[model samples]
Target: MAANEKIKEKISHLPHKPGIYKFFDENGIIYVGKAVDIRKRVSSYFNRSAQHNKKTLKLISQIQDIEFTIVDTEADAFLLENNLIKQYQPKYNILLKDGKTYPYICIVNERFPRIISTRNKINDGSRYFGPYASVTTMNVVLDLIRTLYPIRTCTYNLSPENVDAGKFKVCLEYHIGNCKGPCENLIDETTYNQNITQIRSILSGNLSVAKNYFKERMAAAAEEYQFEVAHQYKQKLDLLDDFQAKSTVVSNTLSNIDVFTITSNDKCSFINYLKVMNGSIILTQSLEVQKKLDETDEELLATVIVQLRHEFESTSREVITNIELQLPLDNVTVTYPQIGDKRKLLNLSLKNAMYLRKEREGRQEKNKDLSEQREIRVLETLKKDLRLTELPRQIECFDNSNFQGDNPVASMVCFKNGKPSKKDYRHFNIKTVVGPNDFESMYEIVTRRYKRLLEEKQPLPQLVIIDGGKGQLSFAVKALKDLDLWGKIAIVGIAKRLEEIFYPGDTLPLYIDKKSESLKLIQRLRNEAHRFAITFHRSKRDAGTLKTELTEVKGIGLSTAESLLAKFRSVKKLRELSQDELAQEIGQRKASILYNYFHNVA
Candidate 1:
């Protein structure tokens, strides 16, 4: 839990106020969080806590710098956190599952406006409302608006001058009574504007204006003894009533509130949100938050609350949840209801979250089963192709590497169930082999690997692969024979020139199909072994070169040479230092000997 001194210094100076904090590594920001007290929240990560998961520990290990922006209130912190996450998309933050935007009802700004549903929100002067979670609901709203008010549905540019010059004609919409023919000036500007105003009220969740208008019109028609006109008004009023009834899923008393509930497993959390306005549930959405730090349900719920509210432009002052939260939301009431309509709303949201969680778990389990079956099938194919008594479930490949007869090394890579078993991979330093003898190096490494396994009474591999032709395979077989494991393990050698496979006693090569799964698996093992051996050889060669250069100085032992190289990193850099500078690192006596040796001075 102890962070480096640099991180500790930053943590000590964090201000005790509301803010958004970002954790950055050498690459970029890795995590972002909101906190009522920045100092306490950031310090919690470095404290000894059993609750920290492996992901959080890794994030803490990579943090190079901490940045924070002070805000006026916790609500401001929440908003800033949401904005920063959307901007940076940090690796350790919960992201919305889908990137699709919800639908909004846009009232286009023009001489005669048209009401339409869109997923994009432009920054023009037009008014947009209802980012409805369901497009069907949005379409229902649009249809009702069209039925109640005969506004224009066409894309005609109905400017004052265009209408006066008779640039447009009445379309079929006007003849069918769906439009007021605003393009042909059949409806006056003031009258068309009155309909737009009432439509705006309906979109804003205030149906009282439209309902009252229809009631007044119906009364006027009835007073004149015109039953047909009055019946039309009655039908319009019933439409409004029916829409309200469907939207108001809970009590009519709940207005301008948000209800949230969360269900989580060890790896992810599902959050469901219900947005209520004017005593009606206008929006309901469920989101999947991929867990990065094994965050508690309360912490995840808080994040979702801020994100969903900002995305949907919710202005609710009250929030109901299934679990209590300790967040400091400015001018907002957090309630956990026990027994009421609000409790029922919370239960409904929780059910949605649970359903999403179950669906995700089932999908993951199915994927896992499919992966296991595929691995088994590949292993079975490999077993039949090689004609082995038992399945080659555990296979090991050996490779030798050297640089022009210098610093020879070998590597052994293991594969289990047709996949690389990195934990069992071993590197050898070519013990008992002189110069660049590939055959002896392979034999020595093969003997040393299994002799130790035999000594430890560990299980042996079912198959062994050598990355060379008959010469290398013969030596490996001899080593196995000497250890009484010659016929026990199925061994083969693959040559690089023609990709030929050779048996222990067989002279001619056994060439499997080029596209066969068995051949591909063998190629993968050989490539991995070669790569591992080359990497180990390069590192050893580099270290030896650095050591030999410094150790050439008279009276300089391996320990001093290693110490110097560790401090200066390279002999080339060591040569650039003056005797005085060298003396500061080693004593003046050894420093003089090393300096004169490098400078060729007496």
Candidate 2:
């Protein structure tokens, strides 16, 4: 490897401490690696005939810059490196990636802390317990907490000074019995802190203490003959037990084991993650990605494992998947279980992955069918409204722009099966029309268009839309009749004022439903023709102005002017050239005269 000055300078600063290093280039970070000794690992690339493969050598050559984060141990380096890889997806490293950050359960730091789930982690002295894989689990925790404790959900400050000064009162939460008037200092700080402590323990999967507390309270209430209070306590105890029973933690022996399962088809893949802590699945999440390069299932699964584990901050000693994956992760036992609780965990993970994949597929198919139905309905409505024998699947629209007759032009836009057909579109230069007469311009284009189609033996459209009121439509009809093709084609005119549709042999115009898809389609066709014609007219006017201005020169004529335009493309470019530069194309005398005219030299 060639050690450029940048690499040598960067390596000189590398410390001996273990850390994660990132190789950044002009684009961004392209490679990331973890090492025990930062200086030795990074400098190894600079040695004579570098001790690395072709890919590593290529990566080394592109390393314009480098950065490192110091961690205390090799384990910390591994965790941090894996995390950086997942986040940046450095091209040189192979790691699973996910698109989102899973939510966490946070207990806010306030006089009366509220239990809330969030994707963003704020370091404001609050306790955050998770980067949960599934929001459902956090939701269940919140519901149980609300039922077990009469905590305040309000945003009022319950500071001792504020409460003593009588700045706040009990709100709806107190009246509804969801809070114990904490803002009014009815519930002391000591009792509130104790409840919050137990809640933290419950979230950490140590639910026995909280359950026992609720059970004891229930028993005391029953002994005191307070049936309603006893019932409430019993309900809270049951909720905790029921939540635990659903997951069915076999034993509290397992901790920090990540189980993954993946399902993929020809075009995409989905993965499910199960974060097993104290033998119960604490976080359940599934993510899907579109298959762009047709990656193997094993490769995709391994990538997902790294991403999920790192994102949830799992430093599990063991990692499990339904498939036997050969990953390069160190100090982690990657296993495929075949029987017992481990097997059950694998199966559950697989079930979730498969279920999510199926649900996504169903939603796509349902959306496609609904879209097709809406299109079909629009066509049917158009057919009925226009009194057509069949659907007008092929439509043509025309618009004329004259710029007050300086360079009259027209454009025709075609729509086949309700979509713009650019290949079938045509532009007319108003060749036979003398001036800005809309009726005459429309008649000329219609006649020439059909006459050529007849000569070429091409197909005719089911509908020809004229963008004007009755006068343009009448001229178009006259042209069709002159060609003895009046009854063969279905033609209509759209009035710009009220958007009224004019039919042949009908005095009154037909007004379609304003909100109808048919009206929208018709409007789209008219607008497209207008946009196309205006663009062509502007270009023609520009070219005409250029032709007139260039021809006004003493020695320039039609061919000379067009040739100069062909070479220069525009007047601005010709104006930018020097006299000697212009003399290379034209004679010295003509160049001098052109330069004199432009520079205002008499």
Candidate 3:
């Protein structure tokens, strides 16, 4: 490396002003910092009096350029620093780069203001509240508002043409007392304004006011001798109290700090920021571009703190979530309090952040569990029943449904870990069978399914389950053998009575696993397929039945039956026609013939 001369020149002209600083490498990746005096902060590396860590020394050596932004005050510097860190998540900084945007509840300032979720907060004639952790939480709060208040939640775009239009008609919500029906102008401005005021009061950490309002309503109802109405009010008041108790934690300095967490399988990061003013979270956003490849949880936490302290101007003694780290706090103090109310608040914020992360993760795991559950739960039971060495990782279930053998359809619902794998779901329409021939339908469906699987060069399942007993199981095995996949995939049949499971060629079923969740899982999959196929078959059969009925009419031969169906829509409508009218509309002779055929026949 070149001598330390180049680093000195960049630090020399640094101004002694309160602002944020950025250090850039040759590749233009930045490491940002904020200080009260830029000159002193930037010159700290050159100070013979100060000692820096090995990582800091390494970072100083890589700096190719230095840049700074001047701000009005330390607070301004602090806020700006956080904004820049979030924008340019440089190396040597703690980055919480979950691409999740904050959700705000936007109550528009309009004639009929609408409550909506937005990621952006602008002065566009609306009141915005919250950088709520998730849209789910915002929605929950919104649902509460809708439940308690009768304020209109409709979009306020009523035009002159629609002034009297029925589009503003009162919905069932008005009758059920969920809304004041502002769309229909049922409630006046003063009452609507009062409701909005109540919403604001409830949101601003004043839960007691809402509770008091409910209590007053309860008292009024009790005085009127309406016990049922009084009970409802009391219940609502109790719920409000519960909500307040859960969220109302007192913090040190009365500052609100939100901790954000982002975790992948092997990596976890926490970002902590304070919201000093009303509903604005400090540094609530971040971007992580160049993250650690093999970073331990502790290292990640340390990196976050060093970078966060460097980038954020506010050094208020606010403890970040989970991760403990040393920070510089001469002008302002940074802390992670371990005791009293501050600790409670810190822990609550951390828990909420972790819970938000988990809820997001749980949704993805749900999809995977659908298939994997089968292997763990279903196959475990199967192994115990069959005394197998290993559990079945791949399971294939086949079902057939039809209406009198018309438009017959078969479905295959696959499970990898005792859970449904929608990606592996396959559907087959019965082409060979006619008039309720389930065995033939099964054979065709199984043969066709396996043929496609082979053509696509896909692996056969470890276990195959047919929705019927020995006959259906044998049919599946035959298909497998024909396709040379028989010995590869295990075959079994799930019998209908008590829903017992049986292997191919077995006369008896193993229904003794009655109380097993795995058995219930298999039964559910098989039943789902049966239900799906039957629905399709019934739809096709019904259409055929109606057409068959229409075809019997003399004037309504195949084309006329099709036309009448195309025109009148249903057989029930055809039943409503008078003989004379039918004769006049169609040909006189043909109509008379049709009228006699339909009305007089049966």
Candidate 4:
């Protein structure tokens, strides 16, 4: 556990500021927690005298290590913690985490760059814009860009060298006049590049140059009595205007503004984000975030803003919302526009948020019904195969993760009606066995799990799966028998080598049908447990790399080092701070000690 001298040294330096903290074992992130005072919150775990419930004790027992990130305020802490929990999905949290990949407009990184809509963003020196909330809006914009510019839309390498060698040919796009014959070098590279420059500027919300350039050309053609050329420009200008009209709800004064509004129900929260470029709503979409920790409206909204912008690849610095909150970010402004176009955009965002909320709820209800039917089928199949009295709607599988007796850990994954019961999944530190003894670890964890359940009078799973061959299964059965729960729960041991199922006291193993849903469910549960355990193990190994960096600073005793770690969390951050800043937290004397250590000016 982190109560060891090294980890305690790390804990003492935890920042007193609000932040998110994670507990890890060899397997992975076991628990993630948010605290207003990270130092105090972390210190509580190691404080021996503190009263702990069974669950807290279970969590604390396995924490071989810890890590944390400091945020500016409590609100930031809440938001960051929620995001981390969703990302890492530590075993202890019950999260309503949901995510979807949105689409982006990529200007391909190539000679004669091709513009297209893609969900994948790879940085190969290509310019990428927008995870457009609406595919319709993105397509519409793409259409306008195509219509306005005779840029190549085809997937051709229009390199000058290739064109000179006559290695490529123009296709239907060139025949239809939708693209200049850049592939044939009929249009010079410099001339085609000029069109690309204007397209780039227009996409970035600066359309004045493009609009003026087209208008000036149109006027020049008409004055020269070239009516066809003038008419063509007029048509392109009109098409551009039509595309802008779809997005433009308000006047052009409010440009490059990101409008955000939040709406919520009991189950989930929705955030609508609208990016106004050149006073047009270039991007409009509402995102849904599942609320797990009962975070406030302000906190949700703030958190959603950070997530959506990053996910959607939005860069608009001027953010407008229906309500105001401290953004606590640099070079970004958060405002509540009460009137005029800004307010109108805000209302539009709110409307989208509300509509999306209702839409999502309807879809979820429909899915719940379908899921219920599917689960019933799977559970019924499991019940018959296991010969259980009740439906095996709840199942649990256990697995241990260890590599050469380093950071040994165990995990249990739960399934409810054949679906992952994520909130019920658990990870355990092997308390009784020091080395890689999977059998003893299994016995200890099984006993602990059932005993704790009995104490709390909680509902036990109908099925308990031991992820091992015969020997490990026997150990688990003994533990269950000791707890007087052997027959109450229908337990089975799954042998990984042959996928054979063994019942207690049965020498002959049950070979389930390879195609059976029951077998698949068991495999999934076992795999999930193994995955959970291995992930924790890797995180523990990674944290070990940073352990030795802090031991060298003089005047920093073990307690002082731990205190510094509890406050700073990172040696790099401590080294980066000025003596005055360091003095404010630690005393002036220690601050000088740290400053001199990093600088070593003598």
Candidate 5:
């Protein structure tokens, strides 16, 4: 028997319960999988020829061993799967790295509190309506408040110092009738407060009452010979007409949904979302990211469902591209309705995704064609030109910034699919080499970079470009060779003699193929990385505050200090932690020690 077959046979006796599973290769790489029935789901994978797609086939072949845990139900299993996926980032799962928790819209606590969309949701004293998808969408709805009702947008506080400031002065918003000049106290507090309440009701979609009140106001203003006032009210009514027309229809049947889309480029991928509620599309956002190291479409869809479930309450039905999740949709219907309104909606969403993918892919192909032409032109003119083994998917460029090496820093910026991935930009402080030693610093940075990559097992970039000439190029090459990552990543150094580029590994000045989409793309990526790296380094060198307050904590050395600071924003906040809270935040022993240290010192 094969090595993996023996292992799978051993675990064949696993109970048929809902839980997470772990798959391991002989080389010891871990890939965690999950299922509702651990025994059945796992055993299914053991069958070599039993129907599997391309991605699944690859995963099954790599599986050398299997392990699982039994949970209470499928729902519990779903949560466990996502938790494990996030903690481990398994090789075969989609990963959501939004880097931000969702934002909630809150009406703060006060007699006249501000309605603001905030990422921080606190129960201190406020009402929160939503964890909206984007700030832009939330703000768009908020902007409608002026047209809906006469809400006071001004600060209610009339401090003694600013009492005179509230004196009448009709601002532009007032002339436009968007505001009632509440900042100038033209409107009384009682009226303003009443207006605020009405505005809130309108925002909640109480359309009938809002329209009735507006009609009454328009009629009353006309009777009072206030033509301008009547016209303003008439305009608001017209605005509401537009608002209702554009607003999504809310169906009682569809309470909550997560619409999915899978889009891809020449390299990497994308998965977008349209989170519906009460039949209205409440939120539409791309999944944190569509692709990870070894993530596939179906696998990503599954991971997204599990991860998304963590952020939301359990829903009765899930609308998907197909039945992919381990969730038992037997009682819950999984219908790909052929001739109905549902199918039409699904098809529309799919078409939107396909169009988005094509647009992205088209741009990339255009850039690729451009880059190739540029490469040819350079080769023709210089007789020595850069050649790639494959079309560069990830191109990296390095640039340094410092004040005479006093605050020496370097950045490694990355581009994927001819576009800059600002998220992947990295910076390094010139630690080992001293004072204007660009070559040695480059060598140190490159060495440390590859060393980290080796330890972390991260995918290497397709191409590496340095923003300097032969000496810097040689330094980078030497570092890569020393780390034995030389041939794995392409190395190129670009230098400008006035407006001309001098290529690495050659003495000749290079000329790019003006007509090549690919060559132009490379230039764009290289230039962007250089710009990004310089911007980051300058910002650091400009601000002399590289030190963190966590360094002052007695038990917290650099690593622990950084971790503590990152977890709790500041040393002051860390100090605010009670013994129990501190223990929970960090650890009991460390927390106690730090607390005592601070107390005794203070």
Candidate 6:
């Protein structure tokens, strides 16, 4: 009946086959893993005599349940584990952090198809190709396609019925000879379809087919003594040759291969993928995945291989990697080449991955240096401007928020070294103060904030900013004086109307130059505190409204009301929803009640 004994029994019954296993806690699945032998791999976690890292030990302690799926091969196990990790987003799996959707060339499926580039790949019978890595390269291909075949750029329907009915006019694209006016019936459907077929060949990286077609037409024109037609075909051939030359040519004999290489640091791994077609590199992409557990190079490479191949929609039968892997992909050859063009291709991919890693590291280092320098400069300027004894490295700002004396709240925003220290920020509901008494609310929050910090033996801020004129500032000063912190820590009040800074006992307020960095920094702190307070106030008011309105429905609770508010955004929108639409969100019974409530029906 014990948890450990149950886990042991479950492990003992695990099949000795390749599969993916999931470790679950009471809440949900926490980890997913792949194994060649499920029983052995699952048992390794329970080995009492072996030393486990803190994370591994923690993962073991939370294993309330285990579930697995048997697969036919290790590759299948790897793929299934990846899918499960993506679906559940388990805490202990390596996360692929790349969220970009590459551009694809879509040939619109219509009577007269138009080839264009798009980032969205919706399936409506349109054929899409090349989730291209470089927009410049994709544009080049698009230009070539347009130059070779004069397809329409306009978005007219161009149906046979529309053309026969004379419901369309020839656009400027037709006038400029860029489009063969299918809308005006100047180009037949069969001829346009034939041009699209050749374009498909070019986009698929089978340039030779398109070249041969042009060559045959040129020869036929020359034989017919049509010099002008032959010249045009010759020009098309020249354009194709120029485009091929611009591509990264590997070897004439090599075609339809995928190359992958990986480089990694302690925290993350980077993988580069190169898609080769017709002996040229057609696409190159780099991926970065954050490491959770201590995974080996082989494991990381395998995961990236599956992801990149699927993302690029690669159909190459041969896959080349920098290291040997037991992928066991059906009808696919996995190779690690040491000396040949394949090796060169793999080296190029590795260079790309390493370059990306170095660029990221360099950018991070530069940003850190710039941030430190800027922080020191701003803090030093502020200290000098305010005539403070110290640099005021830890500054806190307070602002009060209320709507006509309702749901009153205050916010305290902290800044360390001129940057927002969001973790140290606090929000206080005006517990002791009643009505729109800003001075009393300020006094209460200031007293409560530092009193708790002092009792807890936490460090106090170097500077405190009160977001009001002398009235609120005087109350905050009184609270600090009672706590014996007024002289030890510097405090000031900023007036919103004229940007006047008031000292504790000083009569006249100090006004730094309007363009001074020190004044700007103080403005930033004041604005941030006010923004935070306003956000808290709005949420509290919304909650109160939800309780008073939606929660009064016959069967609706707080959670249901919150859900309805989140879905419809406002009660007014909910009132506009039809009964069927409301039923789709909630059940019919609740929807009927809500509909009747909104409609004022008895």
Residues 174-249 of candidate 2 have per-residue lDDT tens digits of: 8888888878889888998889988998888778889888888889999999999999888888888788877654
* Superposition error at 138 for model 4 (Å): 2.0
Better of 1 and 2 by lDDT: 1
Full candidate order by TM-score, most accurate first: 1, 6, 2, 4, 5, 3
Off by over 4 Å in 6: 1-13, 46-62, 97-103, 109-112, 118-126, 134-136, 153-170, 183-185, 188-190, 219-228, 382-602
Q: After superposition, how far is residue 587 of candidate 6 from its true place, in Å?
A: 41
Steric overlap count per candidate: 0, 2, 16, 21, 14, 0
Off by over 4 Å in 2: 1-103, 107-120, 132-137, 146-198, 208-237, 249-254, 259-272, 286-343, 419-460, 469-486, 498-500, 504-520, 539-602
Determine the backbone clash count of candidate 3.
16
Worst 10 residues of 4 by lDDT: 541-550
Q: What TM-score goes with each of the models?
A: 0.84, 0.61, 0.45, 0.54, 0.52, 0.64
lDDT of candidate 6 over 357-472, digit per residue (tens):
99988898999999999889988999999999998889999999999989999999999889899999999999998899999999999999999999999989999999999999
Best by TM-score: 1
Query: Candidate 6, overall lDDT?
Result: 0.89
lDDT, candidate 1, equals: 0.89
Give model 1's TM-score versus the native structure: 0.84
TM-score of 2: 0.61
Return the lDDT, model 1, position 557.
84
lDDT of each: 0.89, 0.83, 0.67, 0.81, 0.66, 0.89
Q: Write the per-residue lDDT of candidate 1 for residues 448-567, one digit (tens) a residue.
A: 999999999989999999999999999999999999998999999999988898988998998889998889999999999999999999988988898998788778889998998777
Q: Write the per-residue lDDT of candidate 4 for residues 367-482, one digit (tens) a residue.
A: 99998998898888888887788998789999988888877888888888788988988888788798888889899889988899999999999999999988899999999899
Error of 2 at 492 (Å): 2.1
Clashing pairs in 1: none
